[model samples]
Target: MKTIDQTQQEIVEEFSMFSDWMDKYEYIIDMGKNLEQLPDDFKKDEFLIPGCQSRVWLVPEFRDDKVFFKTDSDAIITKGIACLIVRIFNGRTKEEISKSKLFFIEKIGLVQNLSPTRANGLASMVDKIYRYVK
Candidate 1:
């Protein structure tokens, strides 16, 4: 399996291909479209991320020492951001997930481009994932 860094590098390279933020935004929306559908049962208040402008739900499962995540958001961009994070951390060991620095977020200019609310939401998502690891 590819390490989280490898996966993040791949995402950075993919984002680098876009010349403009419009294209990047479209790509993110496409990624969100491809995200696995989260079941209705998992969209409870317990799974809801608190800092998001949209309703974001995350459910994690730990199996054989690996963590798998399922996430969804009412907003397309938020869902796409979640998809990026899920791609990096899903199916990874808890130790691996916990230690990742998530440099791709900066390399892809996601943090700088995001609105303050969205940026906070992104941090919240990362925090939620780490909480599951502990």
Candidate 2:
């Protein structure tokens, strides 16, 4: 799997090539398609992400100074969002994640698009990652 840094650079490069939000959104959705599906048991309440419109689960593991994340969501769009995060934070060290300028909503181009609740959920997801990183 590609590291978060690599994914971020790729995203930025991709965005640089595109001149519109629609292209960015399409790229994001394409990235989401590649995310591996989460196991049924992994999507339980204990793994549920708060503040999200759909059920989302992110299971993180630490190894060799890097974080590995596996995520899944009940909503297709949210699943895409989760995938975006995993692609941007997975396989990164705590320091790397901490320094990351993920811009969860902005990078995904959700700044003025997603509902207020979904935006909150996006924030919650990033918070969850930071919490685990610590």
Candidate 3:
């Protein structure tokens, strides 16, 4: 299996191919479209991410000392962003996730392109993912 850093690097490379923010945004929406849907049972109020302009549900599972994430979002771009995070962090150890830095976010220019509300929502998503390990 690829390491989280390797996956992140791959994502960065993928995003780097796009010359404009519009293409990047479209790709993000596509990525979100492909993310596995979270189950209805897990989409409770408790699972909802706070501070998001759109509803996002993230659930974590610990199996065989590895962490896995399942996520869904109401907003297309946000869902795609969440999917990117889940792709990187899923199957990693809690220690790896807790210690890792998400340099890809800035490298891909995702934060700068995002509206402030969306950016805050992204932060909240990351925070919630970290909370899952705690």
Models 1 onward score TM values of: 0.92, 0.78, 0.90
Q: Which ten residues in a row have the lowest lDDT in candidate 2?
A: 111-120
lDDT for each of the candidates?
A: 0.85, 0.74, 0.84
lDDT of 3 at 24: 92
Name the lDDT value of residue 101 in candidate 3. 81
The better candidate by lDDT, 2 or 3, is 3
Please report how far candidate 2 places residue 55 from its true position, in Å.
1.0
Clashing pairs in 3: none
Q: Compared with the true structure, what per-residue lDDT tens digits does model 1 show for residues 11-37?
A: 999999998989998999998888878
Q: 1 or 2: which has the higher TM-score?
A: 1
Distance from true location, Cα of 45 in model 2, Å: 1.2
Tens-digit lDDT track of model 3 for 1-134: 88778999999999999989999999999998988788899999987888787888888888999998889988888899888998999999988888888778888997653344653477877877777777
The segments of candidate 1 whose C-alpha lies over 4 angstroms from its true place after superposition are 113-120
Best by lDDT: 1
Per-candidate alpha-carbon RMSD to the true structure: 1.8, 3.0, 2.0
lDDT computed for candidate 1: 0.85
User: What's each prediction's clash count?
Assistant: 0, 0, 0
